[model samples]
Target: MNKKKPITPFGWAIKQRLTELQMDQKSFCELHGIPPSRLSNLIHGTRKAARYRQLVAKLLDIHLTEEK
Candidate 1:
């Protein structure tokens, strides 16, 4: 079964922007020097590595506000 993987809100935003730019995760990670695993953690809210998360936001030109 090819089930759709559920994405977190942050991941959704990143995915939307990536889709608009026609960019893929591996390419984006390589371009920005972010390790793929870290990116996964950030998008999933698994790890709060502030520096790397900030870098991703900056590179994507996105502003991430507090969830609540």
Candidate 2:
């Protein structure tokens, strides 16, 4: 049986965009001036999405509604 690994929403979106851009997490973090550890925490769900919502939206080129 084939199994899929689970990922957090933030992790999936960032990973998808990075794959499309042929980029790596380290490079993306450096280019965006975001600390790698912060991204890592967000991806791993150690940090709440609300904590970095705006920055994450900016990185993904999407606008977040007020409720988010």
Candidate 3:
């Protein structure tokens, strides 16, 4: 069976915004003063997005609600 990687809604949104901005992960994190590991954790579902969602949303100019 082929399993798809898990991604949260916030992660999806952040990725979309990153693509829109033409920014890479390392540059984005560095420019925003966000630790790469933390962002990586959120993207890969290794950590709860709740911890970093707000900050990321603000940085990405996205509005995120707690519904998902």
TM-score of 2: 0.69
TM-score of each: 0.83, 0.69, 0.76
Tens digit of per-residue lDDT, candidate 2, span 1-68: 74433466767677887888899989988898888887876666666657565686687775555422
Please list the C-alpha lDDT of all candidates, in the order they appear. Answer: 0.82, 0.71, 0.79
Query: Candidate 3, residues 1-68: lDDT per residue as tens digits?
Result: 85645877767887989999999889998998888988877776677656566788788899866643
Candidate 3 ranges beyond 4 A from true positions: 1-5, 49-51
Cα distance off (Å), candidate 3, residue 55: 1.3
Q: How far is candidate 3 from the true structure (C-alpha RMSD, Å)?
A: 2.6
* Model 2 lDDT, residue 4, Cα: 34
Best model number under TM-score: 1
Q: Stretches of candidate 1 above 4 Å error?
A: 1-6
Better-scoring candidate (TM-score), 1 or 2: 1
Ranking of candidates on lDDT, top first? 1, 3, 2
Model 1 C-alpha lDDT per residue in residues 1-68, reported as the tens digit of each score? 85434556878888888888899998999998899988887777777778987888888888888762
Candidate 1 vs candidate 3: the TM-score winner is 1
Give the lDDT of residue 55 in candidate 2.
Answer: 87
